[model samples]
Target: MNIIHSAVKRVVKKSLIVALGCAAMLSTTAHASEKVYRLKLAETWGPNFPIFGDATKNMAAMAEKMSNGRLKIRIDSANKHKAPLGIFDMVKSGQYDMGHSGSYYWKGKVPNTLYFTSMPFGMTPAEQYAWFYHGGGMDLMEQVYAPHNLLSFPGGNSDIQMGGWFQKEINTVDDLKGLKMRIPGFAGEILAEVGAKPTNIAPGELYTSLERNTIDALEWVGPSLDLRMGFHKIAPYYYTGWHEPGSELQFLVNKRTFERLPEDLQEILRVAMRTAAYDMYTQATHASGKNWSTIQETYPDIKVKDFPPAVLKALRDANDRLLAQHAEKDEQAKAIQQSQADYLKQVRSWTNISHRAYLNSQAQ
Candidate 1:
């Protein structure tokens, strides 16, 4: 009887061990079979649009290559998404995993977002990049985006954007009175304060509006992008930039989607986005210079002009007051505004001594 009981105990223990081993093996197979993660990105631009469109493509490619097919990104343009301005809501709600658009575009939905793009007479590209990466700009940006279940990063820079293509040259402050222009965001508010009637227009309709006298002036991007719009043909006067000196587009990711990514994948995505952004900036710089040269040589009818001293001063003053109002209303806005101002002051001193001085000397 004792021997039979001992044998029964041994058999039960062996069966239990076998079942546990099978469970472990199944777990290993399940993990190994996990499929590659694919994310969908929505962009604000139309298909094949210039530097802006190229940035997303570059990011997608870099991420896929680095991850060896473990991470794949699919992009949907404005035409496919049919919601150029709706990128914010779509990403936040998880309708899309990512988005590419200007940070300022979300100013209406999220006021603090306005400060992330470019400000009137704000820091240049190099200065802004320093602020974003080195100066707490990234943390502040995260703070602003966190509540919406999103993360934001600098997508690219347009360098110094041209002020606008004006049908009539702006010679005096008076020239802005009742001027109907397709200007948006904080800049549009400043223009309104200065007696210009600011309006918003879809990018595709900008040319037809300007040509048919529906709008008097419009600022797209720099020469890299403006030449294709043919704004110079209709509006003979090209103005130097003031509002968006370093227009920075934003890359947005759904926080939930980001959190689910493996650690290696998360790092790969960050590096890819940063590289693509820097590459786009380089591309923009080259394209702007090359296209500007083309305009000078081929489009003799297009005249370049700068805002008069008095008008510039007025713009600066109006912008200051507007920012003051913004800062007063929101504590986050005040903090971001001050941080950017402080960072710009520190960097501009060096910029003035180096790039500015060198360029000024070259012009002589």
Candidate 2:
């Protein structure tokens, strides 16, 4: 009887050992399957660039943390890549997995892309965010970029960009005629329609171009960023914004690279990009308020001006004509234009009742 009981105990112990070994093997297999994915990102901004650079770092950190090191993003700024404006082509060609740049920067390469960035006399930041997320903006954006083997996401917003710092005040429409300025995208086209010689200079060269009189005026960003660029020291006239009420930067991803990422990692990337974009907007707003206060206190000589009513009307008319010409040329352009106009019309009405009304009440 004792021998039989011992035999039964031995069999039970052996069975328990086999079950534990199987469990350990399964755990090891699951861990081994969580493969690590690393991506390279190219940014238009230089190394240590303030608000713009911060967005990329924030995105990378979030993705890494959320993914538990399974996903890693390495960013190379303009300093390293030596091609601030070439980001679109680089990512499309798969030289880099991702890129951070303004969608309007590629307007010369892809005309339809000009619509993705802020438009002249367009929606504010909040309104534009609504358009991108809730409206048909994302679908339209995908249609435009997918053919190029890339995916685009909103990188950040610079808030309402201040109109360019000017060597002289813009008193009339003629002032814009023969005016040499560094502006890009659809806004540049509008300036050309009004006889201004609009050009695009890289961000690094903007100060030198304006300082050496290579360009008579230039708009960088609002007080949030422009203050550091030292534009106020040279150009006394700082005009209010008419163009780029909501200047959104872009993130471009190689579609093939994105597709290779696991489902969990893809969602993590999307959430990280989205959160970084919103964080950038808030940072811009905060920095603008702080910097503007500093400018008012320290730089009393800086003259803030608004374009004359007549000049504004001429620019607005020119904007209408140019957009019409683009719409006439491409069905895609027409669709995007219609979508933006409709969304603006719908959202602006609510904005008028809410934000606009509230601001007016507070001012009184």
Candidate 3:
């Protein structure tokens, strides 16, 4: 009995030592991981702007949660920053550690920035995303932004955008001539090529501009956002989208800030941004579906028309010519354009067989 008792005591002593060692290791790890990183972000949208603003909030939340509180992000909207169009400069100069805006908005400052956003007649959301992740799109984007001390990522997608709200129907190519439209980026350039005067206006001023004849027509987003803007009240014609089919917004990070982050935190930010982008796309799709139904029920007088074939052809020709000119002027532009074109052709064939075929079969 004495021997058995002694053996039990020895086993208990060994177990206690093992338990204490584990506790010590856990305490030391907790101390080592206590460091926290905080970042500030500037967004182009006003405070609490629906789909766009939600993206930044979602991304911040995801980063904080995924990093177990090691990373935190604070967001300031355009109203706080007071410069919606200056996101590129703000992030590049490190005035803001990060920014959320459209990549194309910086075309004037960096011509290559134009390609990151949706092209005039580019791939759909799925195709574009595949191109970015698998077809070398992300690498090209990095090449374009790296020189400016900024890192850009896909922030969100607004799905397919509508062409615009017009006071009158555009029946022919001539109708576009001398037309004053509120468009932006490469699409605006294409309009200019076709003799239309295209201008960019702030979101807050769009309604007033169209109502007071400051602009003849303007394209906001699709039904997801447009219904709230009340553009239908002033302009009865809503043309279908052709310009930004898969409009992807961007998140810009300062290079110095990004490099300062630990590798794990850096990966957390990337994953957060990507997940938030997809969330925004799904949200946009849901909102557009709901709002489109609402429009049909509430505003039956709204005329939905497709651009005439002649106008489409003219626009396509203008797009090709502009692209050729850019390609001729810059070798990088040529490479990026070729990359996009090749990827589009490769994926679009499958898309026709899978998506297009399925849709047509269902319709029939």
Q: Name the top TM-score candidate.
A: 2
Off by over 4 Å in 2: 1-28
Stretches of candidate 1 exceeding 4 Å from the true structure: 1-34
Per-residue CA lDDT of model 2 for 35-63, tens digit only, reads 78999999999998999999999999999
lDDT (C-alpha) at residue 210 in model 2: 95
By summed lDDT, which 10 consecutive residues of candidate 1 come out lowest?
Answer: 27-36
Summarize candidate 3's per-residue lDDT along 1-364 as a digit string, tens digits. 9999999999999999999999999999887687899899999889999999999999999999999999999999988999988899999999999999999889899999989889999988999999999999999999999999999999899998999999989999888888999998899999999999999887778999999998899998899999999999999999999999899999999999999998999999999999999999999999999999999999999999999989999999999999999999999999999999999999999999999999999999
Candidate RMSDs in Å, in order, are 3.4, 2.5, 4.3
| Cα TM-score of candidate 1 | 0.92
* Ranking of all candidate structures by their lDDT, best first: 2, 3, 1
Model 1: clashing residue pairs?
none
Each candidate structure's TM-score, on Cα atoms with residue i matched to residue i, is 0.92, 0.94, 0.92
lDDT of 3: 0.94
Q: List model 1 lDDT by residue over 1-364, tens digit each.
A: 9999999999999999999999999999767645589999999899988899999999999999998888999999999999998999999999999999998888879988988888889989999998999999999999999999999999999898889999888989999999999886789889999999998776778899999998899998989999989898789899999999898999999999999998889999999999999999999999999999999899987889889999999999999998999889989999999999899888999999999999999999
Model 3 scores worst on lDDT over the 10 consecutive residues at 29-38
What is candidate 3's CA lDDT for residue 167? 96
State how far residue 173 of model 2 sits from its true place (Å).
0.6
How many angstroms is residue 278 displaced in model 2 relative to the true structure, after the best TM-score fit?
A: 0.1
